[model samples]
Every structure is written in structure tokens, then in C-alpha cells.
Target: MGAFTQMIMGYVYPGKPLANATFEAYAMMCVDCGLTAISSFKLGLYMKIPPKAMFLSQVIGSFIASACEFATVWLLFSSVENICRPELLPRGSQWTCPYNQVIYNNMMTWGAVGPKRVFYPNGVYSNLFIFFLLGALLPIPVWFLARTLPEKKWIRLINVSTIFIAGASMPPVSAVNYLSWFAVAFFLKFVVYRKYKRWWAKYSYLLSVAIDTGVSLMAFLVTVTLQIHNVNGIDWWGLDVSDHCPLATCPTARGVHAEGCPAF
Candidate 1:
């Protein structure tokens, strides 16, 4: 949502960081709020809840949630020292705003630098244009195969839309996150469903909701109680580890030397 809107809005208001940030915020909120409404509506339908009641609930909930979110952001920015400045922050500081750093980069990349330079037809990143072609062409083959080989059940599994949307999380999302989801989904959807069909059918959706809610509550409680009080968690080798390869940012050239990276 932020990326798509920033791409167009950036061109519209080039070099205006304030405008870029403003539009990015609203664009993301619109997407998330809209999706939440849709998902809640579907869940209501599944649970045989009245549509009017569901709509009313969501309307009230959205306002409350938005207010709380605004207050939280205001408090954080108001109280936290060097809130979003990673370089200025102390080592191992919990206030190093990684997500905000991404937003700041987008503001610079699309708003200040402009897509005209970054995605220029004959520029250094010209290869990035291939994705546009791939997005358009990939579905055609799937459609053709599905049509021609209608009897082949496997052809239907090639969902191009799902494949495209799968990368929606990839910019900051790690592969381990996807693997964890895949592992759990395989066990529940395949193994559990096959072995205990009745139990899976009864608790699957509820279990998903419970797990999501539990994690969210736990994080919120920890943030409010421990983090806000400057009480740090115990750090061990495992807890202090960075979840990335050391050579990931190293230059690949024959005579290149990157600080803190082994010479190649």
C-alpha cells in the first residue's frame, strides 16, 4: 500500500518530503482499515452474525483503535530520545526505529530522488522494469495451460495472483518467517486435518485468532510494562544476535573492502 501509493504520489509531489509522508500514512491506513473491514465482515458472515451489527461494531472499533494508535505514536515521539535516528541512538538501544528508517528511505528514494531517476528506462536499474513484463505475461501461460489441459487438476494450483502477492512482505520480511508459517500451515492443514478432521474443522479459525491475539497482547504488555520503564531484557549470545548473514552487504568486486566484513 505504502509502496504503490508512494510511487504515484512521489511523482505528483516530487521533492516534497512532507507530502510524501502524509500521503504514505493515509494510503497505508486506507489499505489496512479497508482490509480489516473486509476480513471482519467475512468472519461475521461465517459466524452467522448480523451485517448491521458487524458494521456498527467495526465502525466503533476503528475509531477507538485509530485514537489509541495516534496517542501511542504521539507518546513515543514525544518521550523517546532520538526516536527514529539509528545513527544517533546508543548501541543495542531498543528505540532504534527500524520501521521508521524504511519509511524515511522511501521518502528520500521516491519523493526526493524521484522514480524518474531510480526507474528510468535506460538507467542503472533498467532491469527492474522486467518485473512489469513478468507480472503481465506470467498469468497468460497459466491461463493457457488451465484452458488447454482442463482435466489436469495440478494446473489449477498455479495461482499467479497469489505468487505476485506473496512478495508483498519481502522487503523487510525474512525467509525464516515464511518458512515458519509454511511449516505450521502444513502440519495443521495437512496432518491435523487428515488425522482429526472434526477437531480441525471446529477450532482452526478460532485457534488462528487466539494465537494472533495472544502474541499482540503479549507484545503490548511487554512494551508498556517493561520497555517503557527502561527495564531491559536479559541479553545472551542468542538474544544479542543479528538475524542476517555477515556477508549480505559486502561488495562482490575483486578488490573491494567493506568495514567489519571479511576481505574476499
Candidate 2:
């Protein structure tokens, strides 16, 4: 998934660092403002609302959303790591096996243990999170840009461009996945604008929360299942592993040589 996301960001954004930066910015925006604000802003302009109100609402809402999102991610990192670590380990592999231990060691060595990796070594994941946090704060400028260009054509163009850029940089799979949300946003913009009076009234905040919660739960379940499968020596998503013996094969299987299959 991460690799897919990287591919999509690369294609959509184009410039090496800049493309990634843009994607991080956009994701942070979504995390902070809930898709509602973004959809509402686009809808409002499409419906010819006063630019001032639209800008104010988007800015204020985005700020609040970003704060909440930051807090939520922090809490999840703290709590989920504690609950998920044991489950990430191999069934019988000890802490000393380099290949089997790397996951747990990385988890702890990355600051899930004591000194936070965000402050120390400042590794890739930490840097990525920091970039995301910083990007969340960029909605202010986005709001300003939206206000400066209230004409529906420009607004739509900009939105589409960014989405395309982000999508292109992402892996084909990730781009396809993220495009689902873009499709939803596009539909909402059209429907909400057409029926302005029923927009917020028909879609309760609870509905949004429910959707987000369901997605998160699904992700968690999938992660746990994959971890368990990997640890149990099952094919991890059917990747090629002919070089290594299946766990079912003991160290002294039929004609297998001792050196070639040490862990047989």
C-alpha cells in the first residue's frame, strides 16, 4: 500500500520532492477538515454563494479539523502500537532472529518503546509524519486561493488538477483506491449544489463519523490478519518464496542440502 501510494504521488505530482510534498499536503488537508468542508466549499461556489462566507467557513473548519486529526493520529499511534506489537511477532521466532525480529525491533527502535524516533534519529516514517502535519496547516492558503478564484471553472480546474497530480504519483492500486474518494467528492459537489437546501440537513455529521470509523476498522482488521498470516509461515500475499523452504519442510527434508536450506 505504501509503495502504491508512493507511485501515485510520483505520477500525479511529477517533480520529485514537490510531488510528494503536494500529496502530503492534500492528505493532511483531508485529515484536518473532514471531506465535508472541501465538498462544501466547492458546492458553495458552484451555487454562487458569497465568497467571503465560503472562505471563512472553509478556513475555520479546516483549522479545527486539522487539530482534531493531529490529536487523533497521535492517540492512535500511542495506543494501537501497544495493542498490535505482540501480534506482529512471528509465532515461535525469538528476538534474536534478524529477519523475524526486524519488524518488532523496528517498531521499538523507531520509538514505540521509549525515546521517540520523531525526536531522535529522525527517520523516514517520522519525517513523513512531520511532513503530513505541516501539510495539514496549508488549508489556510488553499482557502485563500479558492476565495480568490470564485469562478466555478477555475475552482473545479484546480481541484481536478491537484487530484490528477496526486493520483498520478500514486501507485496504480493506490491511485485507484484514493480515486474512490475523489469520485465521492465529485458526486457530492454536484448533488449538494443542485439541492442546496437539503445539503447539510440530509447528511448528518454522524454519517461522516460512521463512514470514517468503518474504514478505520476495516484497515485494522486487514492489518492484523496479514500480520498473523505472515508469522505463521503461510504465503504472505502469495509473493515468490521458492528460494526459501516452506515452514512445513523440516531442516532435513528429502534431498535438500544442509547449506542451501539452513532454516528448512
Candidate 3:
């Protein structure tokens, strides 16, 4: 477990890694994942699956789902980068089309460069990865709790509240680029719940709530901690670099300039 934690921390914090801090973050994420898996198993059991099958299915499903999530982050990052920086893209790439420049720019502004820098100046990749992971893993605990007590309206309300909070905590920008993942999750959840209504019914509402709350809390905490540690006392989440950029054509300017030429 220690070695595994180190490996994940390496990917998350990246530059000049602080072993203790990295370990804590990694451990927190792992604990969160374990809780989610246990919750999922309980929900599965409630859906009438045999105990053994429920355990096996939860293990298999969680592993596969986690792997897919990691893959999704990689793919989404690449796709967004390609779209936003076409001049940097390969000549033969399909994403390099002229018509797609607008699409690319929009995604770049919303997902990769814009929000990334604003929310995580030190390292955007790891921060975004953690955000996505939190969102992906949180449903487990909620599902379990929901199944345990399916009659409560507050559980459903909490789940809905969490979703909104998670969305709110996310970088706070236009919805064009970021909405894709939400849409995907929504559609996928709809299909899963619709196709296996009985199974989903035992935990869907709770699972939704759990995921939302967990993700929002995690993102908020990390962002706040990093800001306090590295960025003086300012609220980094509220800082907007775009608002400070110069509008003129003196392309050689640098840093956070409010007047004079725009920096290249």
C-alpha cells in the first residue's frame, strides 16, 4: 500500500514532490476509493445479487471503471490540446482542420489552458486529473448508503445538492467545454438506470449525491490548500488572468500586464 501510494502521488503532485504531502493526498484518494467500492458492494447486495457475486462484480466493475476513467482523462486532455493548439498539432491530424479552430479555441479557453492556469498554476494536469478522479469515484459510497435506506427524501436531496456543488466548484467558466463530461455522465447514468432500473433504484439517487459531495469537497479543499501554501493569501480560485491581459499589439510583453501590448 505504501509503494502504491507513492506511485499515485508521483503522478499527482509531480514537480519537486513533497513525500509527506503527496502521501497524504494519495492516501486520502485511496481511502475515498475504498469507501466507494464498499458502498457499491453494499448497494449491489441490496439489489438482490448473491453476496459472492456482488463482491466479485463490485471489484471487477470498480477496477474496470477506474481504468476507464484514467483513460478518459488522458484522451480528453489530448483531444482538447489538439483542438486548441492546431498550429502545434501534426500536419496530418484530423483535428487540424481550419473549421475546427473555433471549436478548439473554445475548448482550450474552457478546459485546458484557461481554467487550468486559473485553478492550478503550479500544475494543471495533476489538479484536473484529481478532480476527474474524485468525480468518478464518489458514487460508490452514495450508492451504498442509498440502498441501505431507500425511503429518505433528504438522501436524494443531498445527492442533488452535491452534484450542484461539484459543478459549482469546478473552475467557474463558460460551460461549452466542461459540459461534455457532465453530459456524458448524465447520459450514461440514464442508460444504466433505465436498462437496470431495479438495480439502479437501490442506489442511484444516493450514489449521485455521494459523488457530487465528495468531488466538490475534494476539489475545494485541495485548491484552497495549494493557494495558502504557495500563492500568498489571495484567493487563487477567483483570480482571472484574462481580465488582466493587455489588448494592444506589442506582442513582446510578458507577465500579468494590464496595459501596453498583449504578451505572446
In order of lDDT, best first, we have: 1, 3, 2
Distance from true position, residue 166, model 1, in Å? 2.3
Of the two candidates 2 and 3, the one with more favorable lDDT, higher being better, is 3
Global local distance difference test of model 1: 0.79
In the range 70-126, model 3's lDDT, one tens digit per residue, is 996576466444443545643333233443443334334333333334334544343
TM-score-better candidate, 1 vs 3: 1
lDDT of 2: 0.51
Q: Which stretches of candidate 2 lie over 4 Å from their true place?
A: 1-41, 82-169, 172-264
What is candidate 3's local distance difference test score?
A: 0.54
lDDT of each residue in 1-264, candidate 1, tens digit only: 577688788778878877888898998988888888899999999889999999999989979988999999999989877766756654455676656667777889878877777776424565776887898899999989999999997898989988788878764555777898889899999999999999999999889989899999988898788766656577554332245476777765456698987776
lDDT of 1 at 154: 86
Clashes of each: 0, 17, 1
> TM-score per candidate, in order?
0.82, 0.29, 0.31
Q: In candidate 2, what residue range of length 10 has the lowest lDDT sum? A: 111-120
Clashing pairs in 3: 159-209
Give the alpha-carbon lDDT of every model. 0.79, 0.51, 0.54
Model 3, position 122, has a per-residue lDDT of 40
Number of the top lDDT candidate: 1
State candidate 3's TM-score: 0.31
